[model samples]
Target: MTLAIETFHYRLAHPGYCAIPGAHPGQMVGSGQLFKRHESLLASPDPRRLDLRASLLDPFNHYRVKVFQQHSKIDVLVIADLSASMSIPGGATKLQIAADFLLSCAQSAFESGDNFGFIGCGHGIEKKWLFPKGLRMGRVQELARDLSRVRSGQGGNGLFQVEPYLPLRRSLVFLLSDFHFDLNRLSRLAGLFGRHAVVPLVLWDPAEYADLPEWGIVKFQDSENRRTRTLLMRPGLKRKIIEAYEQRRDRLRHGLRSKGAEPVFIEGRYEASALTNYFLQRVV
Candidate 1:
């Protein structure tokens, strides 16, 4: 089936709380908003920003200085899992869904005056997919096209290699992955986002657990290992598969949360508006 890609608008949930210094002039509190009075300064005071009334009111005529808030810009980065699991044949492949989501984020960041970047990881990170700062809308579209053509392969947590490419300053990071890798390895990866605003998008397919036919033999393959196995599809077996997936979900959520990351689970397709709403709620 053709993928139904939806586009939606988004805004930063919190516009004033970025820890790293930003370059763009904005309403956020920073060192760039001049001509604004904050408090008194005992050491050096700027004559231009001196409060005449406050200085005159003081018995000793102590000077009061005006402080300006700086305008800051944030970097938006989209990190995708390009492992074999993401290439599953179905209504919408995980990578395809990720490309659409990345497009939405690019649009949102562009509108909000933030730089956009993208990185794809499979066996190791794909350097071709890395779009650094100052990416235009046309460039984003080009990257999306390239993303659709890349193939998945055996990769053991290639995401761990992405840390070096990240911006030196704090950034708004969106991670798209199935989280099918070893759970123990996830904590190390999650810790990398401790100082940044991170959103983990978990892409799950219904066929992974819910599409099994009753009372039939089926073949299963491990996407990462390329190992195949045959098993009988029974009600009890299906139930167990689903239960195992749920347990893994819980573990993933807990593991990520422990490292200051929250996982947003999405099945089948993604809605940009829903994602924006989720960010709005979380940021507030």
Candidate 2:
């Protein structure tokens, strides 16, 4: 099915370490607009960048060549939770939102001359949903379509196994999940992703907590373990439930911040502009 994808602008706060030439500021010297420093012609060996005035004024009479920081490409990977909980629908199904976000990432990465990849994790890293970093927009679109049709059934423990699949170099990783599982697991995952820049997109539905009726019998099910519980809802009980959700949000935010990751909580729907604003306000 066709999906409406919205692209967002992003930038690395620090110089990228990739050797491949692309669009972001990099640590390598190459053909770029950002002038780094001047080097001896023998070192840089690029006559086109030779500074005539610097060459003439050299006390040692050595030809000085201008060296500019080379622009580089970084792998942009989306590590999504494909657990049963993610199948819950709010304004949109969580998986559908994830698919849309993936499409946007692919489009944005391509526009920025970067590579895009995706990994969907459930009980383990789902091989059917894995893609290595590449610049092909067609592959991304195809993958997004496939993702939209996925039937989530398992838990998200596969996230622990994702380290091997990730790029050895630093990358920008977008972690999409409702985070219904234990926060301790998230903390561990945060440690595993320390080498990469991680952005946690906390997907939540209002119906799960906020939209509950204050006076009625409520039935809730454990998506991961397939357990169900029925509770008599009242003002006091509803308040407690809302407070619990609020506490979870606080813990999530604090935990992510302590690990140097900023979490973006999407209560009902996904917004590309919110993500763009996040990068603008926090990444720098």
Candidate 3:
């Protein structure tokens, strides 16, 4: 679907933007950057930024002042899951959905003048999957190209590997994944990300649970191992399969909440408007 994406504003404890004088230039609730056009000398009153034109034009040269854009930029990171389960057949794969989400987020970040980075986690932290901090609008195009060739790999434990590279200060992190890993393992990983503002983007496909024939001998293949198993899809078994997915969803949501992170569940397709709403709703 044609999706409408929007950028959002979020308050952070640190987000690397401080009011105090810092080495890095960023948007924050801090004192930095000089404003153009001297409206009031009482504000900037900077002798260095004295606007001679306005000073000469002023009837009394009493209101010459400089204006400044006083917004701090925060880093935004997108951590995507590249595990085999994300490559499920018969629908837009999880990676495809994740790529779209990342693109939308990148657009939002750029519009807000924030830096954006990306980490595609699969089988471990591969060098190819790391997109370092960048702020240009073209960064999203590069990310999209990289994602176009990426497929779900056998790696499933990459989430735990992300903690080391996380931003030192508080940041807005969006983690996209199907989360088919061990519950205990996922919980621990969530705790690691709890240090920052983490939003888990849980991707699920209805076909993964609801497309099985009511009665048939279906051969299911494991994406990671490439192993196949035949199971009779009886009516009772179908119901159980669907129920299990529902339970899994609940656990994933609860786990994130318990760890001080929020979870957004996206089923089948990725809708930019819905994603935007999730961010807006969480603005408290």
Q: Using TM-score, give the best candidate's number.
A: 2
Question: Tens digit of lDDT per residue, candidate 3, span 73-111?
Answer: 677889888888887765777777777777778887776
TM-scores for all predictions? 0.82, 0.93, 0.77
Error of 3 at 230 (Å): 1.4
Best by lDDT: 2
lDDT of 2 by residue, 1-284 (tens): 23666889998887889899988899998989999999999998989998999999999999999999899988889999898989865566788888888888888888888988888888887668788676378887878777777775787888777888888888899989888887887666755458889888998888888899989988898887778999999999888889999999999898888888889998776778998999999773
Instruction: List residue ranges in candidate 2 displaced over 4 A.
Output: 1-3
Weakest lDDT window of 10 consecutive positions for candidate 1: 1-10
Full-model lDDT for every candidate: 0.74, 0.84, 0.73
| Candidate order, lDDT descending | 2, 1, 3
Q: Whole-model lDDT, candidate 3?
A: 0.73
TM-score: which is higher, 2 or 3? Answer: 2
